[model samples]
Target: MKTVLFPVLISSALVLTACGGDDSPSKAPAPEVISQPTVAVKVAAAEPVSALERGEQIYKRCKACHTVNEGGRNRVGPNLWDIVGRDAAAVEDFAYSQAMEESGVVWTEENLSTYLLKPSAFVPGGRMAFAGLRDEYDRDAVIAYLKAQSPAAQ
Candidate 1:
């Protein structure tokens, strides 16, 4: 019995030592962090289309209702030959909404961007049925296209 007890105590002592029996609050070892590789991944930046080109794509949507030629006639909407600096509802012989006529908005690039984003919001009760161009880039492209074709541009 004594011999058996001696071996058991030795076994327990060895296990306790092996398993870190020290009750004194010992700080854990700090973890090692590996540094990243020096080589960086490269990406090809997309070539952006000229504003006129991009706006042409956007204007396709407007062409059904408006024309951009210098002496074009009005369709469902007014001809937009010199629309850039024109006052709202200023197109002669074209009917404009009361809200638009009274809104007093000049078609500056900034104003056009805002109006094209959401026309009804810009001019409530206006007759432009197209919901709006939601993309800022698209609005900018469209405005650029209009600028390129304005009477000044001609």
Candidate 2:
């Protein structure tokens, strides 16, 4: 009895639902015209960073192992206070590998770039532990930063 009554109620609901909305082809609702709001945004041209500035920013990677300020203490790597013109593996308290000590490397801009490219390859067995910069511009910039940190620059 309950099933029969439910079917009758459902059929009536279906008939009423079918008769409700305007389904005429001529009276179909017009396609919605959605207009997105236009927002005006002003973009400023990016200021170009100087080579030294860029190098300084990049030097953050080395900060864990090195210090660039004058008389700064050494970490895993030596304090690079006057590294631009200094000998490799010359830091007093820092331990350097035999390969680096005997490599006879003088830290010129070009030499620094090469070493920074691949420290392990540059001085085989030297313990830099850095996976080289690989980018020439980045090497140049970091060298510029080192030069700026030197006493001669001041």
TM-score of each: 0.69, 0.72
Q: Give the Å shift of residue 23 in candidate 2.
A: 48
lDDT by candidate, in order shown: 0.89, 0.91
* Model 1: lDDT of residue 124: 90
User: Tens-digit lDDT track for model 2 on 46-134?
Assistant: 99999999999999999999998988998888999989889988888888899999999999988999999999999998998999999
In angstroms, how far off is 39's CA in candidate 2? Answer: 13
Output the lDDT of residue 47, model 1.
Answer: 90
Q: What is the per-residue lDDT of model 1 for residues 59-122, given as tens digits with 9 covering 90 to 100?
A: 9999999999988999999999888888988888899888988998999889999999998899
Give the Å shift of residue 26 in candidate 2. Answer: 40
RMSD of 1: 6.0
RMSD of each: 6.0, 7.3
- In candidate 1, stretches whose alpha carbon ends up further than 4 angstroms from where it belongs are 1-47
